[model samples]
Target: MAEHTAARPRGRPPRADREQVVHTALRLLGEVGLDALTMRRLADALGVQAGTLYGYFPTKRALLTAMAEAMMSGCQDAGENAATPREQVLALARGLRTALLAHRDGARVYAGTHAVGPNTLGFSDTLIGALRQAGVDAAAAVQTALLIVHFTTGHVLEEQAATGADPELLTEIDDLHQAIAQGEYPQLAETHKELTGTDFTQLYERGLQLLTSDVP
Candidate 1:
């Protein structure tokens, strides 16, 4: 409502239409993986021409940037009242995992796409501010925060590609095991249980612990 104050303009659609297109794009990206989410498909999903979609996003890069911004919005929704810099950073990491987990190839969609958006910038400010308050130098604070963020995102992306949302990977691992001969791949054969049994929740918590602990 606030975005549509419309001081002047009768021929134009409301700003909400742009947001709707962006949201449609986000959903399409979720349903179909990023590789398949073309502008034409997004327009088809939204029942608009591909040219209309370009009014909101002139190029594939712009569409992707919007989706990345949506991911940041998701982070803001999760980052409410995060008290400390570490907590805020951790909140962002958790938020990303949550968003990517919801989509078919979510982590892949988010990977290498960290353009500054409202949510990310705010949370970043929160984390970096906390670090500065704790007497950390600016360079160290930024480097530490980015390191943790990248590690969290990279780990989740690998997990998503491996497991999907349904834990279908367990079934797939059964097939991979057949290729590992005891005599030739003893290390892998022996560690198969450990590798398969472990889940991302444990991995995330442990890595979070290590990253935070290493920060000081």
Candidate 2:
């Protein structure tokens, strides 16, 4: 194998790291979303030729994976501050949500990429280790960690997607549902107020409890 390089072209600035590339990519992601992020765009943002990015991220999918993994790394100590394993697990789940929510369409970006990278692996290792310390078998520990990841990622995607909907339209739809329920579905009408008031935080906590209930 050959060593990678970041040789700048004439007039280009000197400072560049793999992390810098991801950061620039993330900035563009916030501006234009995942669909518009491309190596050429990133290169233009970073003041480098498109070929420079290939050395760091061979393909667009690879760059996406790196970005997703970078997001995961932000919550590296997900459960580190907690005293008990259960608290650690809860912390990890909550921490992941907070991290993902920090970026625009973060959950969507993360869910779509394959994060078989150091940051993602580190996150998994932390969860698995926490479970193993709590007496779970290795296989079960891995599975539990994955369960938390999958559930939280999916939940956040829906939560973010819901937030992105047109607020006025959402309100109109809610009102329409309530009006219909009042006449046609009396049972639904009775709980329509509560049903429409979806609290993602409460739902996330309950989900964490349910998912980790069997961890012991």
Candidate 3:
């Protein structure tokens, strides 16, 4: 061993490039919240050195933007699918739910980020196109998609927040049921099961049916 040489840093130097690095960084953002995602962590996740990540994402804000874009890409892919507009709308709702559920704190990550990514806009195009194909008027069709997205996101937020299906809410319902059985609330007691029980999945599907049923 003669002369000791230092190992050179890996990855490209910072250039005015965007797409590839943005996409990779966004994937990590979708997995972990922006605050939790660090350059070193991204490098570890990407199997590259921290230096390489810096070349792509100069700062955390830049990285956050990339994540927002990645999350919306699903709509882009959905638009290309052969399914009908109604099906596509429902698919997007389910897809949003799936994506939010995929990573920890997903909904929060997307909550205030104003990312109008192509993938998201693509899904909107598909939803509107399919809705038009199905005879839903332009305005209503747009509103319908917005409603679905809003509800889906809100539902996911609650889903992730609950420790276990919201025990307090369930306990309150139980109290109501007890009051009903004691004849303090006869009509409510008569329909206690119906009131106290819910199948959110079926409810979500039913909501979709009610919303998109304008097609005939």
Clashes of each: 0, 0, 1
Give the per-residue lDDT of model 2 (tens digit) for 1-216.
899998976775554689999999889988887677878888989888888889898988888788898888757587788989878878888988998887788987888676888778887778888888888898888888889989999988888777764568588767778686668787777777666566989988988989988876
- RMSD in angstroms between candidate 3 and the native structure over all alpha carbons: 5.8
> For residue 14, what is the lDDT in candidate 1?
29
TM-score of model number 1:
0.77
Best by lDDT: 2
lDDT by residue (1-216, candidate 3, tens digit) is 789999988966443345766655567655665566787876776666677767766876666656655766665455447467666666767777777666555666566565666766776677777778777888988898787777777766666664334468768767777778877777776777866455556756776677667653
| Residue 82 displacement in candidate 1 (angstroms) | 4.7
Q: State TM-scores per candidate.
A: 0.77, 0.81, 0.60
TM-score rank order:
2, 1, 3
Q: What's the lDDT for all of these models? A: 0.71, 0.83, 0.67
Judging by TM-score against the true structure, name the best candidate. Answer: 2
Better of 1 and 2 by TM-score: 2
| Candidate 1 Cα deviation (angstroms), residue 50 | 1.0
